[model samples]
Target: MSNGTDMALISELVARERLFRARHNPEIRDCYYADATVATSWQQGPLSTFIGAESKEVDPRFVIVGSVSTPVVHLNGDKAYVELPTTTHMRMMVNGTLAELESYRRLIYRVERRDTKWKISRLTSINESDNLRPVIVGQDLHVIPQDFNGLRSSYQFLAYVRQAAGGQISQDLLGTDRPEEVERLYKETNAWLRAGV
Candidate 1:
């Protein structure tokens, strides 16, 4: 049911997932930049600031557990593309409560051989969506997990608004306003999270 190369790619993906589980923020930082192009999405100023603020509040001990069920591999000459099309279950303790999320991520890993060693040239997260509830209130309050879920379910209906308007709307409406966009994305993403893939 699989080829040797397929097995190798799966092994690579598994290794990366393990690193994520290690929850070593520094390692994640390094892994994120193992290649220049791979880190482009993260270099955005506001995104950087967001990460900086979140990292301070998030404990490295938080655990994320998940699995890879279906993997699609495509090879183009020297470049190989791998897509993980399976459901993943990730749970981590946030603010003293275990917050769980289910989502699917499609990732691409590029490999090259130099001398006798095979080196990963680049790894790109092509697309990823998670179905996790929003942690904060409508961009205003910092609520614990229990509180977040309680209120979130009541207003979960707002997600359709974000999905219909798209991220660009949130950007335009909340432009230059850090808190506004953060709240918009949080709400939009929550709507998708509640949708459940």
Candidate 2:
């Protein structure tokens, strides 16, 4: 990245990205570039599909995710790379029992500016780790859901819960278990930013 990068401008875009995903605000299109793309374990394609697939009903037991680390941004002239570390916390009924799934991931974003408008060009994620547990303080998970059968351990519970909720996931998503894929993503996007493409 060139020294001319204005981090302040890039930071605002990051803030708007988070706000656009918040429950209270529903202006998703306004926050993202018209052609932004999103790729993750649960969904891969347009940004709309990723956000639209989420359940609209409000429930305290569940949340889309919880960000644990501040965003790490790399700003170039008209493009930037942003990475936010987050954890997913979702509680739901699994096999007639209340269970929660917590998953850790790195949210990657490719931001760009055109005609003086800054927005996300692509959004991707890399799974780190995850676990499942009974929501109740003293309860135990007895029956392991069939959906969790052949998922990657890094985000197994997350993939299982999402699929059980009528959503599909990509089993070949980038994850901690696959160092090569992670390396590829980082290298490819970083090159994009440097090339100013």
Candidate 3:
């Protein structure tokens, strides 16, 4: 990028790719390469197929997207690494009571420039925290704090919501609940980026 404007545009590409999902834009599928993969707290598989299935399963009326900060992009010729800080604000009914859940996480992406086109080769999510609160003051969401006893506190509320929505949590996902997992993920991603992948 030769100027601030150019850098800003380049940085926005990553965030825009994610926002597309919030908007239910079909073009989001175009942001990934043919073999691209996406791993999250509840799902891991080919990104395109995941998107297609998720679109069919997830309810559109409850879709929520808060905001995404400008992504930090590291360029290395044809390979790139990106980090996007994101907040997912969602509202759902918990046992007939209205509740809100906010999941704080970072989205990491491995991008590649092929044939003059930049596409995400791999995308992974690392969760830091989750908060759940009743929408009405002095009311309960019918969920007990102890219900999260065996769950990772870093993504407890998110996991609960996923389970409530019929989604399964994967133990293999990276999260702040396990520092070693975070370290290993970074180590492997950095190595992949440095190796000119």
Q: What is the lDDT of every predicted structure here? A: 0.39, 0.75, 0.77
Which candidate tops TM-score?
3
What digit string (tens of lDDT, one per residue) describes model 3 on residues 44-135? 78875558764343345687776888788876667778889899887888767788888899989888778766778999999999899888
Q: For model 2, what is the C-alpha lDDT against the true structure?
A: 0.75
Best by lDDT: 3
Task: Please identify which of the two predictions, 2 or 3, would achieve the higher TM-score against the true structure.
Answer: 3
Q: Which candidate do you rate higher for lDDT, 1 or 2? A: 2
Q: Which prediction has more favorable lDDT, 2 or 3?
A: 3
* lDDT per residue (tens digit) for residues 1-197 in model 2: 33344566666667666656645466766767868888876567776666665533324455555555777888777888888887767678765678877778888989888877777889888999998888887786665567568899788877776666666777888898999989999999989999934
Candidate 1 lDDT over 35-147, as tens digits, reads 32332112222223323443231223545455664555544333344444444454443334444445454444444333433344444432234455434433322333453
Query: What number of backbone clashes does candidate 2 have, counting pairs of residues 3 or more apart or in separate chains?
Result: 0
In candidate 2, the residue pairs with backbone N, CA or C atoms under 3 Å apart (3 or more residues apart, or in different chains) clash, namely none
Runs in model 2 deviating more than 4 A are 1-5, 52-62, 144-149, 163-167
Cα distance off (Å), candidate 2, residue 88: 2.0
Question: How well does candidate 2 match the true structure in TM-score terms?
Answer: 0.82
**TM-scores of all models?**
0.42, 0.82, 0.88
Of the two candidates 1 and 3, the one with more favorable TM-score, higher being better, is 3
